[model samples]
Target: MLALLAAQLTLALLFGPASAQTTGAVKLATFKGPVTPVLAEYIERAIANAEVTGAAALVIELDTPGGSVDITKTLTQRMTSATVPVIVYVAPRGAHAGSAGTFITLAGHIAAMAPGSSIGAASPVGSEGGELPETLKTKETNILVADIKNLAARRGEKAVTWAAKAVSEAAAATADEALALGVIDVVADDVPDLLRQLDGRQVIVAGKEITLQLSDLPIETVPLSGIENFLNTLTNPALAAILLTIGLNAILFELSNPGGYVAGVIGVICLLLAFYALGTLNANWVGLGFVGLAFVLFVLDIKAPTHGVLTIGGIVSFVLGTFILFNTSELDVPWATIIALALATGGFFAFAIGKALAIQRRQPTTGLEGMIGQTAEVRRALEPVGTVLAEGELWAAESESGPIAVGERVVITGHDGFRLRVRKLTREA
Candidate 1:
């Protein structure tokens, strides 16, 4: 029995628990990610799958640096009241249940963590990752304290304070401390060990404490689908920002050079996705406005020659807006992204303005300006000036040399109002 207990303890230390049964024993699904919409969706789907399969319970493997307080609460409720028992295991070494993760772990029917794992830090804040004001923080702390306390009440008060400290002081206790304080029920070496240790442990489930008979239960790992992976990838903050940039550029490009539906279509798609992501993550609208203002400055600079002053302002606004948009609690935006956008934006406007100036300096090619290079047949001969038919009308013209013949095609070198300034196309031609 001593050796058996030691062996069981080892298995619990690891998330890789042996199959509880040989066939049709239980279904264990896994999802490890941030608390994003896609993750929420995957959890909901896993719960549904567990119900359909008639499994004993579903185990959710979690490892996240808390996100969106609202989403955490929702996931907590689902775990606590799941029709099938919900086992939330904060698994693998070095994993943690910070902020929202504390609530989730406590809500589970059986909360367990691997060695070197931790849980705590359930403080709440606004969506932009800023600390809530003192008053709001107090209120938020009180609410979360009550929440975790209620869950911990059935377990113990020590667990309750630890839970609160997790959010209040950003406290984190190791797996050993957590188990000792009753914050977690078990600390197995791995999944099989967890099962063995839990084979007959009495725990309250749905208001009834029953020994879980999970021996010989087969465990199947349900992973996120391909579609879910794709959605999750798009939900990244950086990716969303990139999409926004691409979409905005595409639409602007199409506006400058119309008649191409492809750019417009892609722009619309990317913009829609960017809006959706920003909405979901609850981005600061002020930052968004700043980004808009930056673009406005850019367009204004393009239209009116500010001699690069507006362009400089536009670049500064854009860089600041991009940095502010993401709400980084860490090391701000990537230097590479900023450098690339600055170089690209600066080059774009400078090149455009240069091209416009070049066009201005070039010789005229339309209307009266085009009559300069043209040749015409003199209706009557003259020493210097004479009436000539050219450019679809008869005009008074002059030649520096001999008169030209009729029906000759000539280049329009210059134009002055109604006069036809004619010249031969080429000496050889």
Candidate 2:
């Protein structure tokens, strides 16, 4: 009985769980634009989920101009440590993985590119835009070179040399060139083609050699959650700027039209999103101050009724602030967008304030104040107080002069509490 039990235990240990050994559907994640910390988090979650589900491989459809260096490092580490193969594919033609993207692409277990895609330019720069101080520049460049060299050494010597060149010279290559140079593994047309080419290919993952079994497997695309998608969109400099301007203006409009909840709610949400994006991008606070000052000027002009003086100053301040809002060359707020926003902002405030003034000058349309100058018919004789029909509703009306007969038309003069003060209308020569 002991011998039989020992044999059964050995068989079970050799086989283990079938699910853990067998690959499921291919897990896919499509990432585009500037890589961000949010994106890194998304990728991390994806890898965890893929591992849990026994995914055959995690295919990342990547297209980026680069992103945060720290986040890139985190992302690459996650990819390298993943239990399953991580394939980074620069896809859809005309796409190039530049800057931080180069590091991430090279770090993949199997790097690929669509026929028309390209990769390179792994240069690192300060999170704050522009050239760093000399000492800092050298230090950062050296650190990045060492990092890329380490990643490249896994691929081979030629790859290491090319990667070093990418860092030092911002070298780039087409898909064909990348494959030829051994910078990448494959060049295929699309995801399906990529899978076909990858089928039966042996690769080392998590320090163990494994052959891919990706043939005819279902592709499961992992998508960003609603909040993640929203936050990701906020990373765009143009979108962030537009959101900030619109949000401020909306809140200002809400103030101008007091007691309005819709504008205020939307404004607050947009502003919060803008602030979150700005924080992620490491925006200069001084620029924000200038933007705040611009809005203040606008509000002052609207309130004090300047002859466009403050508004003009506000426009200038807004343009200046927008130009300096973000501190990165990779992410620039377009001048066209800024100018358009400035003009639109000026026009929106002008129209909003103008309409507000016009409404203020106009007579009241509802409420106790609105009842004045409106005609009412006496429902019951108004000796002192009686019911009268005004605005299609009957109200208690007190005669201003003498008794008002029933069915006589009277003009509403004013109101106190629920009662309307009325005067009888008479023909005059």
Candidate 3:
């Protein structure tokens, strides 16, 4: 019994540290969209959680077309300095790490890609998606090139050169090409495969070199919170443009016929949401101005009887505005959708305003003015002024042609205050 106890103690001491090192779970998170502030927050939270939980490593499955540069910088900085090793994998067969995505992928301690996935295209453009002015473009491009070079340095000179070309010329590479160029360390088929490949890989984490023991570890997926999901949806450029259009039209409808607060409330809500989205997307203010002008023209057409001329101009302005609003190289806003929405909005307002004007031109149907051209029975003889039944009520009336006798029918020709002017109805012989 004494010998057995001594052997057990020796065995525990020999393997305990190795077993403890591999006990923690691996953390996983998916980021499949533009890089917005919400995405940055979510990643930051995930990293913090991993650190708190003593996770073996944090894996970020990324698929994005790109997004705000400032947000991307924030994410890269956080990821590069994280306590736990971060593995950025471009996954799901055909996903591409574009523009800002390139910076993030390179920032990871272990950069990887799935089979058939791609990376690169890190060119810097204006915030509004247009080419920057030459001098500014040079300055911004140089800054980005320097940053990317640093991120790719550990991968070797080939990767560093390719990364610079990606920014200067928008160069892209497939998974196999990236692996050959040393831009990525591995090409995996899926998450499980990624872990298998990443096992035993050495990575630098917070200034210390560590080997990943990721095989067979439990993976805990971190999902976006409700608020994060909602904010992510607001990052869509097309959705923002549509919201702007609907909000303007609704508010205009409420202003034209202001009674129920339903349209007005809905309009305000939609506009607020749209503004949030536009601000996130860095939409062109000139496009917003055009949209506002289009609505203004619509109101003018309704008020000033412009014979549809102003309405046509409003339609043109609306289409132009929508096009400009979503004109970003990072996002592909459908032209067909923009044109269709503009035409529909313009046609609806034109028809609505036309109907409203027609109603206004109609003769009065109920009031003193309504009594004109109406037939009435003479309740009392009219010696130029007498009481007569008009519209089921007795009214003092004056005869325009001559004195009207009692029990005779008379027609109201006009009204002065409450007195109606009447003329005896003549029966054609």
Candidate 4:
């Protein structure tokens, strides 16, 4: 170990100031955007990377408008149970650590923030999708409050008021306010400054005290790799919603017009993706039931003849179901998307119903059925039987009770043997 350290130092020295700045130094992990599953995986990967690279410490830079409660709690657990000391930093200008982010900042081995950054607003918002159930809401709030308070107490600080306020009142505080309230440990201008500030700080990691030696150390930005990037892409709200919509549409299209291989394959693929996202999001099954009910109603409206009345009911059900579709404890669903889908569903049904009704009501203009009730010309001599020209074709004709005359206009009264039964036209008739 001594020899390895000496060799590492030797390499750093030979490489001059550039490499000397980074040898056996701090590694950084950054968290931006929503508190998604990809972010959780990224943090785990960062911890693993730190262990393998033997980094002195791992600093997680965070900036978010909050995220899912379940994911946030999992991330918090990772931070609290980390092998290498985990430093959570709310960074840069104009960044906020709100809602679930507040808990994350507090759960770190050492919480730090940039001078202009802020944290708190620890209220439990829906999984960024829709409102949660009342029972779930109560249970989640109580549990999260307890957990955050426990983390705070273990860190040897006042946590009761702050944690309770975050959950109950949706409290928020600036960096300076957080430091004043002991919500965070330190506030620095930048990463280098943070390192300088954290050089002698003692933190408990894996239940052991580790002093951070980060002063003047070159920071290695350990970002999420390609696989992590792909996973993150999969967890994106837009992408997930798109998969969900495509899956739903495919299944609906299949149901509307059954026995198609292409639609089935596409539906299965999209549904698989949707299920993956739903699992990651910890979505509520009840919301899924609502969506299913909406689909059922939509199908019923299309299949049954309700004269568009069922279709109107279907639109209402669809809108409500779509809004309730993602109401879960773990993450939020996009409200705008739900609204758009409702509008789209209404439009598609309207157009489809209009076409179907028009087809039903259309006047027949061709074939034998079309010639009935049309006026005709007498073409043959008939004491009571004669040929008549009707619908641009001449055919044998007869009158039921009287003889018809030839070369006279007549009115078709009925059909008899591929021809029209007509009565001769009188003057002004």
Encode model 4's per-residue lDDT on 156-212: one tens digit a residue: 555557767787777777888878878888889988888888887787778666666
Give Cα distance to truth, residue 35, candidate 4, Å.
Answer: 4.9
Q: What C-alpha lDDT do the candidate models reach, one value each?
A: 0.72, 0.86, 0.88, 0.74
lDDT digits (tens) for residues 1-429 of candidate 2: 999999999988886643453468889998887888888888888888889888889999999888788889989998999889899999889988898889989988999999889899876666655566889878888889999999888777888889988887778889998898888999989999999999999988888888888878999999998888878888999999998998998898788778968999989999998998888876777788989999998888766756478888989999998999876555779989999999999887677568767877899887998779888899999988899998889899899979989999999888898899989887750
Ranking by TM-score: 3, 1, 2, 4
Off by over 4 Å in 2: 1-22, 256-262, 284-290, 303-306, 327-330, 333-336, 352-429
Higher-lDDT candidate among 3 and 4?
3
Quick one: best lDDT, which candidate?
A: 3
Give the per-residue lDDT digits (tens) of candidate 3, residues 1-429. 999999999998996654554568999999988888898899999999888788888999999988888899889999998989899999889998999999999999998999889899888888877889999999999999999999999999999999999999999999999999999998999888999998988877888777899989999999999999998998887788888888888898898779988999999999999999988877888888888999888888887766688888998998888788756555745787788788888888879887978888899888998778989988889998999998778999999978888999988899999999989898951
CA RMSD per model (angstroms): 7.7, 7.8, 3.3, 6.4
Better of 1 and 4 by lDDT: 4
Indicate the TM-score of model 3.
0.88
What's the TM-score of each model vs. the native? Answer: 0.81, 0.75, 0.88, 0.68
Q: Residue 113, candidate 2: how far off, in angstroms?
A: 1.0
